[model samples]
Target: MIEDMLRTPAAVQDAERHTAHNYHPLPVVISSAEGAWVTDVDGRRYLDCLAGYSALNFGHRHPALIAAAHAQLDKLTLTSRAFIHDQFADFCRALAALCGKELVLPMNTGAEAVETGIKVARKWGYQVKGVPAGQATIVVAEGNFHGRTTTIVSFSTDDDARADFGPYTPGFKIVPYGDLTALAEAVDETTVAVLLEPIQGEQGVVVPPAGYLPGVRQLCTERNVLFIADEIQSGLGRTGATFACELEGVVPDMYLLGKALGGGIVPVSAVAADADVLGVLRPGQHGSTFGGNPLACAVATEVVRLLATGEFQRRSTELGERLHAGLHALIGKGLVAVRGRGLWAGLDIDPALMSGREACERLMERGVLAKDTHGSTIRLAPPLTITAEEIDHAVAQLAAVLAG
Candidate 1:
């Protein structure tokens, strides 16, 4: 009877009945996951091509991260950021070092991190940059998916994310994605920051022009505006680089990092910046109760250490080249086009082919689990720890679906 409770479809039905209908998830229910593979309750195994939206960059239940979580659990878990714990200082310090910055403000999820960044940018605008309080604006790119919070959603260019959500938060300006002149023209005296995804993941893993980031960095510097890179989806080794901005030898003033920061075990995210900019906050200005809990700190610490080795980045780079080549090889033959960087890709299907959702359902029927984004785009972002053999297997499954 207890085993019956473990049935995936039953659990899924219970969830649908109990939870909100915000997400239209796949039918398959993952019972157990490891590395790049997840097993359903029915004992069917599938390669997790999506990698939990790049949160599992270290892979599911990574041994080092899990051990860190277990060890922390035995000691202490949460202190509510009331007085602070032994792990907070070290965690913040590690994140600061990784970000190549002098300060960090920890948060729980990607949305929360984005919110925190927005607040900081606003404050910096008013207090530091001396913009009119309410007139302080943040420039955001169109087609950006920063997070799901109300304030975060206010600036979204997507109608689905914006419609029925207003009256929207004010002080946001939108411009076309990847347009340097548009971004430059949009910045003004009241503008505090220009936030962008170094590589848009949710919006079909959209890669910007080669010089976009570097150009943005230059523009922000010349205009005395902060260049905020929302690395929430594209950072932490997901793009085969430390940060996608690194591809152009540019470093943004502020980094909104999440997803893989907690090593797929817990929700841990943070905003990192240099001292003068982040030093805008004083005591009691902003805080999160569970921002730097011991458990999240421990796991995230392991995540940072793993990233320092460059192993995952190397793996993603090697596998990504093969993947992109394989996918583009199918272009015009099956796939309309392939767009993305590293292991994350966006496959635009031919008009005659099925929609991305339909293709996902078909892939589910096979042994590979991929999630679709826009109507025609199927996103592929497997774990950095996945083997070449698993890569081949996933490609074969995807190619078969394309052929048929």
Candidate 2:
């Protein structure tokens, strides 16, 4: 069994040698997955802590979601936006109801949903809010991880992600994350929206300061600017809630959702808002060929259902306490600190003890799997369906690694 894994498969090697080195994944090539674990090409199993950046909130190949996708595929897969399909309205209505919003604009990926949100905010700024065209600005937090679009990265403060990516896209202003003062001062007459993540996941799961979210929401309302929460990485029971904003009892004018919306089967994402905010887009302004396709719509409809039940959210909340407590036990030893919500937590490590990548490598060797973010932080975002025993076991492995 060990020998089989020692032999790198041809497919993995070829892709490594030829593909762009955008990501440095751990050295396990997964062949199948179920629940909270994944089997590698050599049939070795590991508890999945990353969970595709919270994309598998319902876990791998959830039976209900798969059934929906299969049932839809048997009927119709793609009708495109040229015409609607049977599943489209059901999915839209379901998601809209879940979001408690009047409208939904389905898309295929987090980036596209974010892009759609930006467009929607801008159009509303012009058509409704009466902002000047092309002069509209969106205030984004400094450490935000909205998506990897040219425009998204254009405003990024991370040198690695922003350097040489431009000239850069304009019409965006950046302020220090978690700083309400900066956000308050950044707004002007031309500001259309304040686009931000509830938790800065890509920035190593940085949680905002207390009262920050409610304050931002208030600011947007008072300033007549839309509040766009990019919950793509932090939503849908991943943060132990239907949406991360619930922790603060705040609601934004628009929500950007993705990752878990596909139930880990497909890439389905969407933006939700009231008609007054998102109604600016007419029939021809924007769309995608695969957006709201029958297959994705069907799959996403089930995904919303799973999240609606309080089960996933309750599990995440209960497990999150254990996960964080277990991780907190390691702080000031080998770990620097632990910060996150729900099933996702980013642990910062002592620089001299071990880098986050080294810790991840060690964890991988020890039969658990997780990934590093930024430089010295490892993000653990297991599925909400993960068992308590699995969390304890993974924590034990991490404890052993720290002890060493």
Candidate 3:
């Protein structure tokens, strides 16, 4: 017991000493993980509820993904964008088919995908829409979390992300989220696109009001502005649907995808769009050196194949209903509200009982791991592989934490 107790704190201290203070993670020092569970340095296991902020939506080291990565390691890895690799065409074709789009521009991270989308939208505005140069603007929502890039963080509503990150990039207009009127008013002649998350994942998994997404689609269509859906955190079966926009029967002009696309193995992200919108780029217009490499493509191709089977999506849908029901039952007891779709949820615990951080720390003690957002709100996004009994166990642990 003494050895175990000393090991974790020493490991944690060593980690803290070397890293930047960008994150305040839980005290638990994880040594290894599998689907929906992780083992700490002390060999104690904990249910993984956050799923690497939805990056591990397929769970840790999925068999198919791991196999693909292992096979590719022995073969070619990178060819840059200069020369086409053999694995490129198949991965792009499969992902484009999954998105129902004509073209896919692969990147290495979600932020890169978002940046690519923004650049494409601006180019489309100048070439196709004949917008005045330097006047092209994009409309975004408040409380949105796109990425931490300088341009992205420039328009961020969060002070922690935006503050001290200047001189900020201009040309973005922010409006209240879920308010169609405000969004419509924000767009004008210079507006080139409407960038939004159908379901704001980082914002406590906040699902916009029903019909809000379709409304935005209509507004963008009527205004002749591109609609870019940042599905980095909410897509790839995280919300039961292939894309959260599908839940509303709406389709955006461009889809920014990441996270689960790598299947928890490597960094992979892409932008999917129809030919006309994405074809605006000429040779040398935009590219990534490591984007669409052989290894990334191989693993991502398997990831696409996994999604094609539809098992994960089905699991998310069926399991989500059960999870939401359990969360709803706790509303009066300790939770003030619960918001999300599919397996994703943001639980607002009663502040009178404890802050979200305290609740998560308590949950960590109980063998379940979760993350907190705005002060009193905790987000739960377990892998689709989680079983019903595991869901019940997590909920019961939360109840016990609240009671204490």
Which number leads on lDDT?
3
For 1-404, candidate 1 gives per-residue lDDT tens digits of 85566577787898899998887899888789988899987888988998989999878899999999999999999999778789988888888998999999889999998898888899998889899868999999989999887898899887877789988888899999999999999999999999999988888988988888889999999999999999988999888898988877999999999999989988999999998888999889999998989999988988999998999889888999988888888887779889888888999888588899989988998989888887978999999988888888888888899889
lDDT of each: 0.89, 0.90, 0.94
Writing each residue's lDDT as its tens digit, candidate 3 over 1-404 gives 57665578899999998999876799999999999999998899999999988999888888888999999999989889999989999999999999999999999999999999999999999999999999999999999999999999988999988899899999999999999999988999999999999999878999999999999999999999999999999999999998999999999999999988988888999999999999999999999999999999999999899899999999999999999999999999999999999999999999999999999999999999999988999999999899999999999999899889
Candidate 3 ranges beyond 4 A from true positions: 1-5
Candidate 2 residue 262 C-alpha distance from true site, Å: 0.7
lDDT of 2 by residue, 208-272 (tens): 98899999999999999999999999999888888999999999999999999988988999999
How high is each candidate's TM-score? 0.97, 0.98, 0.98
Q: Candidate 3 clashing pairs?
A: none
Order of all candidates by lDDT, from best down to worst?
Answer: 3, 2, 1
* Number of the candidate with higher lDDT, 1 or 2: 2
Alpha-carbon lDDT of model 1: 0.89
Q: Which runs of model 2 end up more than 4 angstroms from their true locations?
A: 1-5, 9-11
- Model 3 misses residue 151 by how many Å? 0.4
Q: Kindly report which residue pairs in candidate 1 clash with one another.
A: none
